[model samples]
Target: MNRARALWERVPAPVVDIVLVTVAAMDLWPMLWDDTRLGVALAALGCAALAFRRRFPLGVFLLTLPVALTQPFAIAPLVALFTLAARSRNRPLLAVCVALAAVTSSVPWPLASFSEVGRAMTLIDFVYSLATAVAPVLCGQLLQAHRDLARRLAEVEEAREHERMLHAQAVLARERAQLAREMHDVVSHQVSLIAVQAGAMQVATKDPNAKEAARTIRSLSVTTLDELRTMVTLLRASGGHATELTPQPTLADLHKLVESSGTQAQLSGELPPTVGTPAQRALYRTVQEALTNVRKHAPGATGCVELWQDGDHVGVTVTNSPPTRPSLALPGSQHGLVGLRERADILHGTLEAGPTTEGGYQVRLRIPLSTD
Candidate 1:
């Protein structure tokens, strides 16, 4: 069936015109014995007009009008009428064309003689012409109506799909709100209590080592609580993108990020002077998550951070050597790497993370610079 439709579409317009002309010639051949050579001319002209029916529908219909008056057979003009109705439905124009067909095709018996029988025959001719013209016009109208209904149905389906997506987003927002509340109430409270206990320990301790350890614990606890608060606030934000008053970290802040991790890390290479915010954030998070993974899963490993611009893209790579000491910790949510992948997607960038040939874990990110 598909191949048949393909072949039909590939058939040339000139070939179609030639086929129509052949049919018209055959229709006119029977009438030649009546000495009306004009039948051949009218048939040829009518069929030839169909070649431009799609481009000039009304004009082609008008061109075929002569055939309706000169001959009893009018296959070409009927096809023209069908084409006009299928392409565009103008009630007044089609009505006029149908009326003209009925009137022009009516026999001229009244002109030949004023007998009652001749008038009756002319009426019969008019009725027959009207019936023939009406059939093709009705068929074309049916086709046009079917096309209109299909278009409307497709639009309604698209609207329904859009509504479904919006509802899903609303549900996601509500769930995120609930999660933010839980983190703020339970997790933040426990971390805050730890900070307070550490502070108390610093004040009560007498040994220098004990005092220093308590101070370090208090500082770490406070920092952790602050980070949790920031995360919860971001989660509570109402859109796909979280908007904060402060600017997000950039390439220049990479140094501070590595230093804060407390791992034996070194950064090498020059940074681009200007970078898109999305790319900068993606690379920063890529480096941040890579460092966190090393700390949690590959402890006491030396870390390397490299940032550079190559052609129209900026790239960052982070690598960590194998852990010197093994631990019994198992993987949790793996959300850090998941979040990094999402960030790279948002920037239309690429990220790769896995163990390297040298028995070390590595993460690499490459982001194209936006022309805009």
Candidate 2:
């Protein structure tokens, strides 16, 4: 069946029409001896009309109706009616074809034959002719409807699959961005501390203070390495469980971050005990980033960090005096401030960073404690 349909599809319309007309001409061979020359010529014209049925179905239909009226024995009109029904998408054209077939089938029978042969043969012939003409028209309508329905269903399925792909890509992009933010927050402060402690050890090499600084650097490096390994393991796991990653640091760790800044620093305000893990971590990282920027950009400057909690939000401010003498350069990219801003925005929070009025630079971060 598949091979036959492929072959039919490849055949041109003009060739198919010629073949159909030739078949119709052959079907009339048995009737030739019973009819006159004019009748045979008319029947031949009806068969020739079939060749144009697909191109101009209504025109072919009108032409075949007259031939069927003149010679009821010819089957060309019935074939032309079927072609008309199949090729034309217009409903009115289909109705016209069916009506012409029915009228042509009924008009040929005589009123006097109502009594002869008990009228059964005439009635049966009328019924058979009508059925034969209408059957192909009905089949063509059904085939066209089926093809239209299948095409619509295929379009709907393709649209749904495209939407699913887009949604999957969006989810993957969000997960990747969140992972990058986590790595930045976890690793940046530890690296800054290592750099600071190493610098102190280099400056005080002969003193006992240099030994303490070296030991602190060693301890921080080892802890940072352990945390990095744990993070890698969590990334490899199937589900992203927050507990599997590093524990979120809170206000308790702010003092260590400040100490690592290696400057005289003052801290104020009693941080709220009720802050949840997310808010606490965000606040901790904000202060850490601020102080790291201060240590690198404003060396040997006094700094102050303050924290305050209201009913449903916490505010943090880190300020440091301008450098007395600017150092050569910093060893890290200056994206800590931008990362802090993005973190605040992710939590639907706000951050402000600029030079303060007191000859210093200040970073202020505010985070909502409640879930969105």
lDDT scores for all predictions?
A: 0.80, 0.74
Candidate 1 structure quality by residue, lDDT tens digits, 38-57: 66676677778888888998
Report clash pairs, candidate 1. Answer: none
Residue 126 in model 2: shift from native, Å? 8.8
Error of model 2, residue 276, in angstroms: 4.5
Q: Tell me how candidate 2 scores on lDDT.
A: 0.74
Instruction: Name the weakest run of 10 consecutive residues (lDDT summed) in model 1.
Output: 108-117
Models, CA RMSD each:
5.3, 15.1
Instruction: After superposing candidate 1 on the true structure, give the runs of residues whose Cα lies further than 4 Å from its correct spot.
Output: 1-63, 87-96, 109-117, 194-234, 240-246, 271-282, 293-372
For model 2, residues 4-119, the per-residue Cα lDDT tens digits are 98798899888888888888888887767777777678677778888878787778777777556555566787777777776668877676677667666655533454466455
Model 2 Cα RMSD, Å? 15.1
